[model samples]
Target: MVFKRRHKEKLIEATLFWIGSLTIIILILICLFLFRDALTLFSTHSFYSFVTGSLWYPTADPPLYGLIPLLLGSVLVTFGAICISVPLGITSAIYISEIASPRVASFLKPFIEILAGIPSVVYGFFGLVVLAPYLQLWLDLSTGQVALTGSVMLAVMALPTIISISEDAISSIPSSIREGSLAMGATNWQTIYKVVLPAALSGISAAVMLGMGRAIGETMTVMMVTGNAAVIPGMPEGIVESVRTMTATIALEMGEVPIGSEHYHALFAVGSVLFIMTFLINLAADIIKKKYRFKLEGS
Candidate 1:
């Protein structure tokens, strides 16, 4: 019986290891596919022109394929999204983890989870039909679909991820730590602000990175709301202006682009860029998670 149990455990371990390896294999396959398709675009255009040139007119005679405006648009909306989500998500997590009564936490947690579960299409529709008009009226914009509108929708989508992870991190801190802080005569607010928050700072940062990744890669909502105009903003408030992100550019044009054409390959190249951006973000999250896991364990 002892030998049989040990055999079973070994088999389970090997099975789990193979499953994890499959995920890496899948990621490699995807990157290779994107690179294969993107090579056609690279053969004709200089790397600097592809990345730095401002124009994106793919249908004009001898079409230009600069990624600068799309990259800037993506950065603008993502920055705005992070600005909105991080503070509110962290605050709400703190409230739920430390301050809220059990009943309140239970009630609020479900709603936040529901927000994450909602389909991206639904969010896009809501932004288009409801939020857009309000934003145009409030900001005095010519149209409702602008970078700020996309940012608002993405911030909503990213909030649940940030809140869930941050709350988990704060809750994972041993209760004894809280007790020790209180025993030192610290006020409840002071204990949370100085003790709990600092302890969970790494995890909170990981949560923010993950949320930012989600916001940056989001396609439908950004496409529907960001006016689909590929242009670089000139001012700080230019984030409120109409713009189009890389994801939106791919989603908007990939269908009509003929196969084997430069336009089609360029769209694939854009997707490759988006893939690399998300890959870097997930890598950062992984590093932070491993670092903090060990740090917390050692502490």
Candidate 2:
């Protein structure tokens, strides 16, 4: 019996050890795959021109791979998504954390999570079928496929992420803080605004950063809704004009690109830019959190 128990323990330990090792190896492999492309990008192109230029004509014999328009389109759509999502998400989070009854919270929280689980492709389909036609009629645009459509879709997709994170942030605030504010004759809303929000600002900021990352990386939905025009045709006036995004550019063109071609490396370079941008945003959030943490701990 003692020998059998010892063997069982050994087997368990070996299994766990192998699992951890395999996970690390898989992560390394993924990093190498992504990094290989980035290295190729640097080898093939001037980093300055690739990031800063305006044109992205990859099929052209020389392939002017300026990523500015794609970058602009991504920023525009992400900006629109943030505009739509932040206020709505924050408000919903506040309601869930501070205002909603437990029954209401129970009902709504899962629904919001369910919204998050809906695939991007489905969101794309919804945009194409339902949103595109409505926008065309309402905006009197030639085609409904535009940045606005993509923005709206991305906003919807980002909603659950923002809401969930923000809700957790709000919920993390100490009830003592709320009670103290109320003891000082503050209204519930006032207490929430003055005490809870200030206390939870770090986490809320993190949530926004996370949502921004999601907005930046989204591909299929943006591709489906944004009319894949590489050119923005002067300053973007409305959502009716076609736009192309970096992720979309990669998805659309990578398949056709010959192995080791300039266009292929250029796409990887664009992806690297995206990864760096999102990483910086997240790093900024972390810095903000640390700064606030220092203040909180010192006080």
- On lDDT, the candidate that comes out on top is 1
**Which residue ranges in model 1 land beyond 4 Å of their true spot?**
289-299
Model 2 whole-model lDDT (C-alpha atoms): 0.88
lDDT of 2 at 129: 96
After TM-score superposition, the amount by which residue 81's alpha carbon in candidate 2 deviates from its true location, in angstroms, is 0.2
Candidate 1, overall lDDT? Answer: 0.92
The 10-residue segment with the lowest total lDDT in model 2: 231-240
> Residue-wise lDDT of candidate 1 within 1-299, one digit each (tens)?
99999999999999999999999999899889899999778888777799888999998898999999999999999999999999999999999999999999999999999999999999999999999999999989899998889989999999999999999999988899999999999999999998888789788989999999999999999999889888887678777789999999998898898898999999998988888899899898888878877876788
Against the hidden reference, what TM-scores do the models get? 0.95, 0.89
lDDT of 2 by residue, 185-236 (tens): 9998899898899888888888888888899899999999999888743465
**Model 1: per-residue Cα lDDT at residue 5:** 100
Q: CA lDDT, every prediction?
A: 0.92, 0.88
| Model 2: residues with Cα > 4 Å off, grouped in runs | 1-29, 42-44, 232-239
